[model samples]
Structures are given as structure tokens and as C-alpha cells.
Target: MSPSGKPPRAVDIVRRGLLTRPWRSAVEAVRPPWSPQESQFTQACTRCGRCVEACPGGILQRGDGGYPAADFRHGGCTFCYACAGACPEGLFLPRDGRAWDIVATVTAGCLALQAVECRRCQESCADGAIIFRPVAGGLWQPQLNRSACSGCGGCVAGCPVSAIKMEHSHGRSLAGM
Candidate 1:
């Protein structure tokens, strides 16, 4: 039984996989910058790979279900908006505005938090969102300035511990271009 207290739908079964595998992530894919909302983008994208081709960073790749997704391990987004320009379906938002509401999240496994000396993530962030502030016991703790963040995934790749991930800011709007 599902949390809704009803029989799971066929889509749910497929989403949960062959029962041997763990349940799939609800956020199945990370679309290109300026992309429309998830459900809309999935329904409208032609899977043409135009946006993926236009991405110079090479971070955008064919993700789950063949949809475009960003892999920050390759590199962070430069916000060139070339992906938006290449899309024929207008699936992406206008480029005249901010790109998206995504931002970096550092988990407990972060090296610095674990008392390990590491500044790779801070050095990688061009926006200076990741700042190491001195704390008790002469330890420097990494602090995130959410306002200074552009959700560019710049900090994700440099984390040697892989403690960083991009998540929604849940702001007033996600109409970033």
C-alpha cells in the first residue's frame, strides 16, 4: 500500500522499479537551465538533444528516461543560455532573467565539517557563496550564503567527499530564464 492508502498504479510500479531495486527519485531529472517545470518539460521536450549539444560545459547529458540533465561532475553551468536558444519547443524560459532557483547544499559528510582540512568546494565557487568562517576550536566551518548563490552547481564537483548537491531554493518563483 502506498502512503495514499490506495493500490499503487502501474506507473507507480514502474517508477518503483522491479521491486528488487529501490524506489526511484521523485526528481527524476535535472533539466537544463531556463527549462520549464519538470512535468511540463518532460511532456514537451522532443528529446532532440539540441540543448545537450549546445552546452559547452558538457554538463548536460541524457539522463533518466533520455531527458536532458545536468551532471556537475563534468563542470558547472556558465549560464550561457545556449541550451535555451537551441530548443525548438520553447521548453525553456526566457534568457532575460535569472536561470533557476537551485542552490548548493553541503551535507554533514563535508570534509571541513568532519574536521578535515579541505577548501576545494570554496575555491571552485566563483560566486563566493561558500565561505569558510572560523569557529570554536580554531576550526573553519564552511558557510553558505544562499543569497549569493546562483544555483550554478559550481561547488558540487570540487567536494572531495561528494557532500554537495543542488536543490531547489523554494523561493517565490522559479521563472529563471
Candidate 2:
């Protein structure tokens, strides 16, 4: 309630929530085309973990706060888009001809850096999008060969640390892919 007797705005409340942390604010600011549904659905989601279990591709996971977040870089998302169908909250986005629409970024847990033997991230790639190469010390690093990648997110699902990320393609490729 305010002196004017009007109710506080919901956007104001969201602003406060985001202002609490710069990192979170930045993350919230970088919303992808699919993010509106993600934000709206996450708010509505009860955090039941049911959708996580239902995901055959395993691209979905509970965030540190125990909310569903799609980690796409560590591995890749099959983009079967089933998560959208199973989510009671309607959190997942409709892929209808849009599976390749989303672009992803690699920030952490690249199996090539963690363990050379584990090319699971590369091998599991459904679209053959990830290109693995041997580098210094004979280590393999995962790279998204955009030409080959269909943006399926299989690598994102297979990553153990949930390091990979799906973002709007920046029209560039990682150096070591």
C-alpha cells in the first residue's frame, strides 16, 4: 500500500528481486526468445522435479535453487521439446520447427577440459554439431561447428556439471572446437 492508496506494481517487485544481485540481474537481463516462457513457467512451477525425470534427453536439471534450467553446452539438447509437453507449468518452449532456432554457448564443464577420455559430450551430440580436436597435451576440447550442429542439446544433457549453456548464437565459434 502506498500513500496514494494504490497497489505496488509486480514489475517493481521483480526489479527488487533482480537488484539484489548483479550476477543474477545480468543473467535475468540476457533473456533468450524462449526466456519469457521460462521465467513465467518457472514462477508457476512447483519445483516438483517430475519434468526432470520425464526428460528422456536429460537436458533439464534443477538449478542450485532447485528450479528447472536447461543446460545445453555441456552436452546438447535433443530438442525433442518434450519438456514443453510434460511441464505442468508450461515452462518448456514449443520447438515446432524451432529446434535449430536457439543458439547455445559453452562456458563450463567442457568434458574436453575436464577429462580427455570422456568425449561423452562430443559423442552424444545428436546432430554431430560438436567438433572435438586434440590439442596441447593431447587433450580434446568440445567445439560447436555451427555448420554441423543442429542445436539438439544432447551434449548439454550429458554433461555432469551442467556447464554447457544454450544462448542465441553470437555468430562466432569457440577457438578450440
Each candidate structure's TM-score, on Cα atoms with residue i matched to residue i, is 0.82, 0.49
lDDT of 2 by residue, 80-148 (tens): 556556666665455554443454455656655776466666666767777677788878777777656
lDDT of each: 0.82, 0.56
Question: Where does candidate 2 have its weakest 10-residue lDDT segment?
Answer: 26-35
lDDT of 1 by residue, 77-172 (tens): 999999988988888888877787688878889999999999998999999999999999999989999999988887887887778877788632
The runs of at least 3 residues in candidate 2 whose Cα sits more than 4 Å from the true structure, single-residue gaps closed, are 1-20, 28-96, 114-116, 171-177
Pairs clashing in candidate 1?
none
Model 2, residue 92: distance off in Å is 11
